[model samples]
Every structure is written in structure tokens, then in C-alpha cells.
Target: MAIDLLKRVDEIQAIGAVPKILETVAAMTGLGFVCIAHVTDDAWVTCAVLDRLAFGLKPGDELDVTTTLCEEVRDTARSVIIDHVAESTQYAGHHTPRIYGFQSYFSIPVFRADGRYFGTLCGLDPKPIKLSDPVTVSTLHLFAELISKQLDAENRQQAARSDLSSERETAELREQFIAVLGHDLRTPLGSIALGADLLALKVADPALLPVVERIRRSARRMASLVDDVMDFTRGRMGSGIRLNLRRHDSVHLTLEQVIDEMRGLHPERVIAASIPDLLCLDCDPERLAQLLSNLLANALVHGNAGTPVHIDARQQDGKFVLSVSNEGQDLAPEIIGQLFKPYWRAASRSGSEGLGLGLYIVDQIARAHGGKIDVTSSAGRTAFTFTLDNVRPVST
Candidate 1:
């Protein structure tokens, strides 16, 4: 059951050269009516037409498939040509000529590029014409071939456009879905954190203090994961990480603050910092703090827990340079290359592992500031460095 008749008809009509083909065909063959028909197992529908004999058939018109000679053309995958139907031996008494009163007729089978039968390039007239001449037959074959090739090209282009549209729609839905989920989840997380704070103040038992702290930590981690997911979607969706850039007189203090916070979070781990005093820089302090925090968190998680993580921030040659390094087993070239990609993690997993978006977000922030993070892993130390040139110092 080949349904969707209109779609098939439109496909044929979309070929801009189809009308000219039909007109040229009718003129060369001396036929009063010529058309391109979409023939199927049980249907014969006109797709395009050049009618001169009051044939009363136009595009989208249909005829009983069983009553037309085109049906034989479709069945045989061969052309049916008749110069004088009434004088011919084969079709002289054929019911088709008497029913439609066409003395001269030709229906050349037109095939799709995939070798499936499509329909026919056909013409008809009341007066007999020299349609059996080899020159005329060959020219008609060429025209039919031209239409077949053109139809295939049009269909391919339409399919490509449709695929692109579908891909874009899927990407939009994915971004919207993740953005909404991240936003909706924050409200409950905030409530849990607030409740934990209230519990900590009221609970006097030493046994319950740790429980209250655990709840606070879990809520905060969940909130951080939500923020990472939202940022990931935004970065990939062509809107990079947002920033509020301004001159800060104590950018080095911002770096020190991040290190101090990380130390408080993991009091057991040792961290070493070397940042200059009164370092002035034009940058988004909060975003830089986040970038440094993510790097420190990643280092603390993956670096050798027994070794101290080192942070170095400085301003030299009118540029700000920051690097975080840890002593650990060397990472392979492949692993180092994929470290900045989102959701990428080494095979080993610890209970403290996050959603693996830290480095990816770090890279995004660096790029947003017109800088890039460089990685060098060898020996027993791995370092991630962020460099921003042309820095503007804060006014005195």
C-alpha cells in the first residue's frame, strides 16, 4: 500500500526543470498531451502535465490504473509505442485506444536511481504520429533519464536539510531540559543546607554534630554538581561561561582565599601556596577563584594524597600566570589529552570523585578570559597552567 500520494507528487514537481521537460517532450513528439505520472502498484496519478487536446487531466489527477496502457508499461518495465493504433496489429483492437481515443501513444518507463520502477514519461494524440522513429525514441529516452537523475538529486538535498533540522531541534531540547533540571533542583538543596545550619546550632550532643555536618556537606556537593551541569550545557550551547570583569587590587588574595577554603574542606591534605602580595589584575575575581578551586579539587582527588599540592600565582611581563601542580604517577599522553574534556575520568574511582566536569569548566573559564590552560605531565609531577596576557593593573 504505497500511500502518501501527495508527498510523492510534490517530490516530482519540485524538480524545477520538469515542466520544461514535458513541454519539450510534447513539442518533439507532436503529441497533444504529455505528462509525468506517478505509477504504483494500484495507482496512476499525474505529477506534471502539458495538455493541449482538452484532455481534462492535470497534475494530481488520477485514472483507473487498469484502464490505461501506462499500466502495461509499468508492469513490463518497457516502453509501449504505437504509431497508428487503429492500423496496428497488436493494439488495433486494444481496449485502451477505444476508451481514450488516442491513435498514437508512447509510454517510456522511467526508473529511479535505485533501480526501482517509478512511473512513465508518456504522451497521447488523436492523430497518428511517427513515434517509432529511432531518433524520436532515443530523444525520449534521454529526456526520461534526465528526469530520473534530477529527481534523485532533489530527494537527496531534501533529506539532508531534514536531517539538519532534526539535529538542531534535538540539541535545543537537550539544552532546555538540562537547564530546567539544574534550576529546579537548587531550591530543595538550599532548603536542606539551611535546615542543616539550624540543626547544628540547636544540637548540643557531640554525637549529632557530625551527622548535621554530613548533611550540610552532602547538600553542598549536590548543589555544586547541579551548577557544573548547567555550566556544561551553557558552554557547549555556544554561550561560554559568564563573567563580571573588573580591577581587583588583591587578586592574589582571591587565589589565597580559594586555597584556604580547599584546605579547610580537606584538612588532612597539605597545600603549599606562593602568591605575591598586593597583586593587581583586571579579571573576574569570583570566576578566577572558581577556576582555581576546581583545579585544586581535581589535584587533591587525583594527585598523590601523601604529597602536598602546590599553587603558584604571579604577575610578570604584564601578564598574570597561575599554575597548580601535584606530585603523582605520570599520566599517559592520551589521558592527558582528554583531561579537559567533560565527564572524562581515569579508570580508578574513589568515593570522593565528582561528575568529572571540573577540568572542563576550568578550560572554559580560561578560554572566556582570552587565555588557555596548558598541561605538562612527565616524571612524577603534573601541572596545569593558565596564562592571560595583556593584563591591566588596578589603579593605585
Candidate 2:
């Protein structure tokens, strides 16, 4: 089947994990060059590449389909792994190895969910290395499968956007996304986190610790993105945020812990917290912690760094009131109105920091708790207060 090569390239890039996958493949297999290519009947195009051997191939770059083994994979629907091209009887005299001057090579076919061939996750190294280990081969194959599943997710998301006006279709799409995000996306991330933990335990080099930490951090960040998307899906699908509500006498302690954690994360910035001991109230402690974390993160990103963000949590007039305020430029009333909407970012702060669902999730949590978040911005001060009605505090 013919495919739009440009659109395919964009789809691969949008997965956000392709580059990391390529880099991880290279590191794992000791391959100098790794890439995810779009293989078709008459064309072989690089969709994403990690070039450590100066192979010089980049995204959108093309090579003659006849000269690449990926085309052979496309034809046979099988992977080709040659640990040592010079010693392998099957490919000793192959023209591809001779032309590309590679002693090690592998091309694993990636397929869509419906079994249609998409492309190959291929790598090559000039020096011969053991690439045929059962674990190594299986890991690479798993990576290819991850790409295929992510491609399905990207396609479904595009379709969902196109069918926004159709309520039934939108619900189905949300379910599809929830499944993909909950399983396909998070499964690999959990593996990455586990691998990082194992690597940290085994590696003794002090200099390599930071690299391990970075891997851990990236894994955490990706997991967080998955979580945000899942919450957003649940919130928008009209089910609302799920909560584990229970009575707690020391909810203030959880709020204080969240503030302390944020302070530790951003030592350069000041966070003024006043969380007094409060009587028992009914709420989801874990969900409230998540809510506070999201609010603090939002303030830290959009709030002024020079001034301290003030957080006050206490009972007020038979109601539970928790407020977070920061000194910053007053948000326009129009902008403030849209602050709780999903995927909304301010024009001045359009960056790749988050998926812009933090505030939206916060709003959902408030609603789930039979409360509402009110925003007030004036004279360089903005506060977000959550007030849950009919909070009759009981004695501990």
C-alpha cells in the first residue's frame, strides 16, 4: 500500500520516544548507526536516526530501496541480523555490506496493529559485534513493536481531533487513547525505569552516574506525561477524576509534605507555607496531594521566581479552604477564564515544558471533591483557592 512519506515521517517524529529508542538501540547493541526508516516498495526513507559512526543519514533523507536490506525486510516480512557480515555464510558476499562497509547489521520489521508492514528498525556498525544474542534481539524487536503501537496511537489521536464534533466517535477515541496510554506507552517506560535502576546499581563509574540519573529522569518524565494524558482522558470523557475519599484528621501534614518536596526541588525559589493543624475532614488524601503538587508546579512555572509563593491551608467558617498565591503580573480576565481548560497555554509562555493539562486536572479534582477552584488576579498577585462546601470538621 502506498503511504504519504512526509506524513509518515511527521507521525514517527510525533511519537516523542523515537529518538530515545534509536539512541537506546545503539547503546544496547553496540551499533554505531541506528534509525527507524519508512520502507515502501520503491523508497527507503529515514524517519529518525542516531548516527554515531557518521553514517550521515538524517530524518527525511532517502536511499535507494534496492540497495538497503530494509527493502528486503519489507518484502519478506522478516528481520535480518548479521553479527559479522564477513563470517556469515548467508551474507558474506552481499552487496549491501560491501557497499555500506558494515561488519554488523540488523533490520527488524515494524508493522501496524492490522499486520500491515510499516518500516524497519535497522542498525549497522563498522566493527563486528555480537548482535544475535537472544535477549538483545528480543529487546530490539520489542522496541520496534513499541514504535508500531505508538504509531497507532498517533493515528487515533489525529482521527479524534478530526471527529471532535461527533460525540460518539469522540468517546470511542478517548477509550482507545486511554488503553494505549495506560498500557503500550507506560509499559516501556516502566522497563526503562527498571533498566536505569539496574544500571545504577551495577555501574561503578562516578561520571556515568549522571547519565544514569538522566535516564531515570527521562523515564519519570515520560511516565508523568502518560499519567497526565490518562487523567485528561478520564476528565474529558465525562467520568471525571477518580478519587479515594476518606476521613482524615491530619490532611495538613500531607499539604506540608508537598510544599516541602517542592521547596527541595526548587531551592532557588522560596515557598512560604502556612499549614496549621486542622480537625478531621472527609477527602481523598492522595488525590489532594496530587492536586497540591499540580498547583505548586503550575505556580512555579508561571509565577515569578523572585518572590515566594504563599500557601495557606486551614479551616475557615466551617469550610475547608486551601489557597496558593504568587506575586506575578496580573493575568487578564479573559485568560484567567480559560486557565482551567485542557491543553491551554498562555501566549507568552508557550514552551515544551508540559502538556498544559495540570490546571485542567486540578479543576477536575476540585469538582470531584464537591468543591470549586476560584482564581483571583489583581495588582501583581494571583491566588487559586479551593473551597469545599459543608465541611463540618469533627474532633479527632
What is each predicted model's overall lDDT from 0 to 1? Answer: 0.83, 0.82
**Global fold similarity of model 2 (TM-score):** 0.65
TM-score of each: 0.58, 0.65
Which residue segments of model 1 deviate by more than 4 Å? 1-162, 349-352, 394-396
Tell me the lDDT of model 1 at 153: 67
Tens digits of per-residue lDDT for model 2, 247-347 = 88888888988998888778999999888876467999988988899999988888888998999887868898889999899999999999998767789
Highest-TM-score candidate: 2
Give one digit per residue, the lDDT tens place, for model 1 in 10-124.
9888875565466556645668899999898789999898778889997888899999998999888999999999899999999999999999999999899899988999999
Worst 10 residues of 1 by lDDT: 347-356
Clashing residue pairs in candidate 2 are none
RMSD (CA, Å), candidate 1 to true, equals 26.4
